[model samples]
Target: MVNDMDNIAGTLQQSLIQIITSVLTVIGVFILMLTISWKLTIIALVTIPLSILVVAFVAPTSQRLFGRQQAALGKINDQVEETYAAHTIVRTFNKEEDEEKEFNRRNHQYYQSAWKAQFFSSLMMPMMIFIRNVGYLVVAVVGAIQVIHGQITLGNVQAFLQYTNQFSQPIAQIANLSNTIQQTIASAERIFEVLDEPEMDDKIKETPVLAGKNLPKVEFKDIQFSYTDEPLIQDFNLKAPRDKMVAIVGPTSAGKTTIINLLERFYDPQGGHVYLDGQDIGSMTRDDLRKHIAIVLQDTWLFTGTIFENIKYGNENASDEEVYHAAKMARADAFIRELPDGYQTVPDESASNISQGQRQLLTIARAFLADPEILILDEATSSVDTRTEVLIQEAMNALQQERTSFVVAHRLSTIRKADQIVVVNHGKIIETGNHESLMNQKGFYAALYNSQFAGN
Candidate 1:
């Protein structure tokens, strides 16, 4: 709130300075006009004030038009960014011409709004000049009459003409200043809109102790959640023993990933509570809860860095030997050695230099180095080749030995060896058992499994 107040005060000060400077410049011009003839000074004073009044009346309308133009430009930028980010998807879906048309439509709208604003703003200067010129003509005629009648000297008439030019200068400056002030105001409003948005409450009130000697079980009791008003999961419950493998299987949008998000506290659940060793997850610091968990997402994201750096992201202080061991355990060492620079080879921006399988292996290596007590593998091997999948499976088997692991995958083959498989449908756990037991039940799990292995 204090920051907001400071920003508002700063903007007001700047705008006031601009307006005051413009008015002061006009007063300086009026002073020069007085050196002319008193008759011409009277004419100059009336015209200058009238021009200012006209501009003051028009300024608000011009601001509104300019604001609309700026908003249109912002929308065009958003569309361009979206189009570039989804360029591959757009091309794959043959949306090139369609996207081009949409872009053109938005571009045209921006052009129209910008041109309209310029049209109005441009009128101010020309209109001011025309009105000032008429006043100058009137002064010239009146001064000539006065000189002829011996009321004013010829030198005085010349001086009055010079003063008329001086007076017009400030009027022109004021018009430009008015336009600038409107633009500054428009920009401030947009900036403040973002600053005024509601931020998520991220403060932590307490910290939990995490150590090798005392690891606690994770429990979910009567948990319900939703991204919107409609609940995704209701009355959901689960308990993960300190060191056990729990595989959650579900069809698309059955809320499998939502559980992982809840566990990580990316979002708080709408109802019930998540407990870690009987302590509410919300009550504990978010960082403390996440320190014990290591997740390998399906869509692996590799920063533009060497394989060694990417893996070391999990633990910045990890020793070189620990990093090498983790890579070897994930079966990523073989590929790293094949590269020209081995572990030092820099990855491309989108990691296009490496195969999808290699990228997944690198992510897995990162998780291994973190040495987290709780592991989450979300479709970890879905994008890899069969041979690579088998290698990762072996690595995962070794890594899952002492940690509580949660595996979420659509590939039925991957979780066959899991200690327990919980089948979920419509955000509810419809079946829970081992591979053979779930198959014997002959429900959703059996049908899904049969559909995949029927040809085999």
Candidate 2:
């Protein structure tokens, strides 16, 4: 996208002036040629059609090749980004050679498309020059014949030839511009495709009435959703009361995260509705809805900034004192203060400067700063050690005091104390009860939970 934008910008800045200049020069020279010798002017004008033919033949091919080149360039960018981001994993798995081979393949694809595009575009200028020279030779011969027959003065014939040369100069200039024009069109096509895509639905208005005495903090009603054409979740319904911790657990591909995604409005259900505080979530603007929720994912995201800035990202208006307090609550303050620059320490681009657990702690601190009405922890403690996990669990218990919390966890021990344990399998809720009740029932949840500790 960046490369394409640069191409578009350059074309607009330079080609606009060149086009205007060429058009005016072509018109001015054509009139001069006609006034000097109309007969010779006719001969000069004949070559214009041939020049047009050359451009017609080459310009479309150049555009298509440039489009292919841009697509290949995009693939190269993706390859480099993925390879570097997963550099440690690749080295650990001894797959460096595989990564290098993939990168080389993408690079070669880019080279192939780029070479063809440039070669075709470069053909236009020389082709135009050849056609113009042919017209020049014919015009010169005819002009001399007119001069010999006393039909025109030698000076006039000479001036007409000069005018013919001037006329073809602009034509050649426009022909040369065809290359840049084709590239710009290819770039603009890509940009416009993105710009013209349908925007996410933001049609909801009017705050939902939360006047009911005991409305659920979050509720999903007869929900149906799927990432693909096949249904993944169907007829899913849940009512999570305010100030309660709801734990969702199941085997892999059990649509555990899909439930959270629906509540977060990341993907709206194809059917039914999600309500927050008695108002249909779909009837609320995403910004308005998201302001009430905070989520910490398994993969922590932090930019290259100080610990203070990273925590303050959740609430930009938060004071330095608030950031410090949030970090302390998340148990991140002690380690952060021990660092060389404490809160001022800048993390690397990938935040690899800090341990994985520390990165997770920073994200939790960020969530604390958000102070949202709802909290979501999706495998948030997965990266930490047992000791760190206990600290996080303690911090989370404190953070979940008043807010409704949803914990998607694989370690059943972490969510054993949840107010509600919802076991899902193949998208349907198979069991709903507290840990004690579910364990006593000896259902799927009990079997799954007991299996974890069976070996331990």
Candidate 3:
């Protein structure tokens, strides 16, 4: 998508000047031909209509093929990216041949579209050349007869013939540029499609309602949402009291992460409002809402940058000392310092140089440094060792002090002490209470909790 847009931009920029020069040249040469002999000038004009018809015939087909070509290229890029990004999984599963075959399929699709688009675009120049030559032949034969009848001079006829070629030259130049114009149009359509999408409302409401003194720090009010036509999280309501830890535990696809996504305003509920400090989150700018919240996701993402820089991304204005302190709090400083470059260590593109647990720790440190009023940890300790989990839990316990926290955990053991343990299935909360209370009730939460320790 990006490369195609760049090519479109370059084509447009170059085409603008070429098109203008060609038009002016055509106009100037036409006047000269008229001055030499109006009869020959009229003969030359016949090619203009023919050139228009050729473009009319070919432009749509060329544009359509180019669109398909760009689409195929996008698929190829996606396949290559997905393959390389998951190369480890592919090798482990012995599915390298499957991946290669998929890549070849996408590559072949690209080849098919590209050749057809090129073929149609290439036809424009030859067709224009053919029309120009026919016009030249007609003008020459007529000019010869007129010169012999003494109605027009041989010198004038010769000059008119030369002018005819000049006129045809610019026309052919413009015809060749039709291919580029078609490509640009195709690329521009893709770009514009994105640009034309309805923008999210960033307007902050005046007279914003403040959270009631007794209200929860974060609340989902009668929320209704769905990823598809099937309803999910219908009439879902939850509240996290100020300065409390709320743990959401569920099986896979139980909409645990979806709850976090809602709280962070990643997706607005289709049917209800989310409140922050009693104010409708929809009324606040996304930046404002996000500033008060920080999330550490299951997947650790580290760009190609120094360890210190990645941590400081949490708070760009944070001092070096503050960054180091945050890392220590998240239990990431020890591993970071042991590295060859210490804080200056630049992780590779995938950040595979460091261990997965280290990457998660760094993300934790980043969230800690944000010092947000609301902290979200989605499987933050999933990648860490048992010992590292203990240290991170301790740091998180301290970090959650006097701040609202949401922890999405798969391991039942992790949220034993949470103020509120919400057991979710599908999307609705099936059980809500402290772990001790739920275990005593011997409900779904108790069964799920007990199953984990069944072997032990």
RMSD of each: 6.0, 2.7, 2.4
Lowest lDDT 10-mer window, candidate 3? 203-212
Q: Count the backbone clashes (under 3 Å) in each candidate.
A: 0, 0, 2
Better of 2 and 3 by lDDT: 2
Candidate 1: residue 313 Cα off by (Å)? 1.6
Candidate 2: pairs in clash: none
lDDT of 2 by residue, 135-233 (tens): 989988887887788888889877887888889989999989998999889988999999999987777745555576888989888999999998999
Q: Work out the TM-score per prediction.
A: 0.77, 0.90, 0.92
Give candidate 3 misplaced runs (Cα > 4 Å). Answer: 13-17, 149-151, 203-212
lDDT of 2 at 159: 83
Tell me the lDDT of model 1 at 370: 95
- Tens digits of per-residue lDDT, candidate 1, 1-456, equal 232344446647875776677678768767766665656788777786778787887788888887777778778878788889889999999999998999899899989988888888888887888888888898889999999999999988888787787777667767766666666566667777888998756765353433454534777889999898888999998878778888999889999999989999998888878877767788877888899899999999998778899999999999999999999998899989999999999998878889998899898899999999899999999888899899888888888889999999989999998888888887788999899999999999999999998999
Overall lDDT per candidate, in order of appearance: 0.84, 0.90, 0.88
lDDT of 3: 0.88
Instruction: For residues 153-203, write the lDDT of model 3, one tens digit per residue.
Output: 989888888888889998899889988888888888988899999886566
TM-score of 3: 0.92
Q: What is the full ranking by TM-score, best candidate first?
A: 3, 2, 1
Better of 1 and 2 by lDDT: 2
Best by lDDT: 2
- Model 1 residue 273 CA deviation in Å: 0.7
